[model samples]
Target: MTQILNGARKCFVQRGFHASSISEISAAAGVSIANIYQYFPSKEALIIALIELDLQRHRSLISRFWSTDFSPKAIEELLADIFLTPEGHAVAVLRAEIASEGARNPHVAELLRDSETGLIGSVHSLIRAAQRRGQISNELDPDLITERLSLVFEGLMRLYLFSPANGQKLIEQYYRQFADTLRLRP
Candidate 1:
């Protein structure tokens, strides 16, 4: 199942969600078409599964950050890990694909909504924790802060995908600027 999902991701990235065929996924995965069908009923199912896997990893990263006790140093590290990296061009491309697919496919859209809701909830918790510690301003609504950060993330992904060669450096600069502008207090 993992192999098939990986293959589907590779094919989708290389040929796009609509253009990529099951046979292409099978070839990429080095598995038979029949085998893929046994695991995933259709191409859409495979794409959903792949997105689910990525979402799981993302949640894990967020959870790890959530588990750490809040400190200025820890917050800085978390911000760098979350905002300053491109997460690789392949993953970025895949993310774009998923977003576009979500717009046109109801199933994908629902999955994305659920996944994003969880992500936003986790981020809101982190922001509230930081506020409690006086790392972030108490005046700012946590929900609004979370939404703004999510927009920043999406904007960075777009800029990165536009010019992947300089994406990491650009992300680093953007996050640095954002951090500097923040009124974080001890």
Candidate 2:
């Protein structure tokens, strides 16, 4: 069942939630459609499952990465490392899918919200840490600061999503700007 779910995620990432047929998913999973349906009742169910899996993975990443030891600059490097992987490529696809399919699929939209909640929390924690460590002013709104950083990160991802030719320069720009904005007092 787990294997099937992983395969289904690949199919959805590659062909998208709307266009990917059960047969394609089954073939991608190396299983029959009947067997696939035995676990997931419908294509919608499979998509939900995939999104749920990805959301959990995102949460796990945040949990693991959340630490006082690693600075935001270091975290950005870690992010770049993970996002450059083949499986990491799914992040871009998932982001694109959420933007395109959110209206048609409430599940996807909810998953996106769930993801954003975790992301925002992670950023909030980071900012709070900076304040505690005297890295940044304590008067700032952690939510707003993190939201702006997230916006920059997402904007960079958006640029990279449609045009790989534009490359990591834009992503690096985001990292530099975010780090600069979050830097400690002199």
Candidate 3:
């Protein structure tokens, strides 16, 4: 199943969702088409699996927020891990492809919504925790903060994708601004 998912991801990244075929994925996986069908009923199912896998990884990363002392440096590291690394760039590209597919596919769109909901919940928890620690202002609503942060993250991903050369600098600027805004003032 992992092999199939990895192969599907590679193929999807290279050829996109619409152009990638089950046979191509199977060949890339070094498995038979029948084997793929045994695990995933359709290409859409495979895509959902990949999305779920990505979500699991995100959940793991978010969990780290709870274990560490909340600080601007920690947040910056998280952002860098998401936006600046080679693996991060690959995931961003794959996410863009998945998002494009979701625009036209109701099932994909629903899955994306579900994924976002889970992520938002995790972020909400992070905000609440920061508030408890006096790292962030308690006067602000966690729900609102989570929503705005989600928007900022989406914009950052777009900036990184569309303007690679300046994306890192722009992200750093945005992060600094974000850190300043959230930090509690004496």
- Clash counts for all predictions: 0, 0, 0
lDDT string for model 3 (116-136, tens) is 887888888887877788767
How does model 3 fare in lDDT? Answer: 0.78
Where model 2 places Cα greater than 4 Å from the true spot, the runs are 63-73, 118-122, 165-167, 184-186
What is the C-alpha lDDT profile of model 1 across 1-186, one tens digit per residue? Answer: 888888888888888999999988899999999999899888878888888887887788667655565444564576455444554677778888988999999998999999999898888888778778766678878776666656776777677777776654665655554464345433
lDDT for residue 150 in candidate 1, whole number 0-100: 67
TM-score for each candidate, following the candidate numbering: 0.82, 0.81, 0.85
What shift in Å separates residue 127 of candidate 1 from its native position after superposition? 1.4
Residues 118-164, candidate 2: write the lDDT tens digits. Answer: 77877688778768887677987887777676677678778777765
What candidate 1 gets wrong by more than 4 Å, as runs, is 64-87, 180-182
Least accurate 10 contiguous residues by lDDT in model 3: 177-186
Best by TM-score: 3
lDDT of 2 at 51: 69
| Candidate RMSDs in order | 3.3, 2.8, 2.4
Q: What is the C-alpha RMSD, rounded to one decimal, of candidate 3? A: 2.4
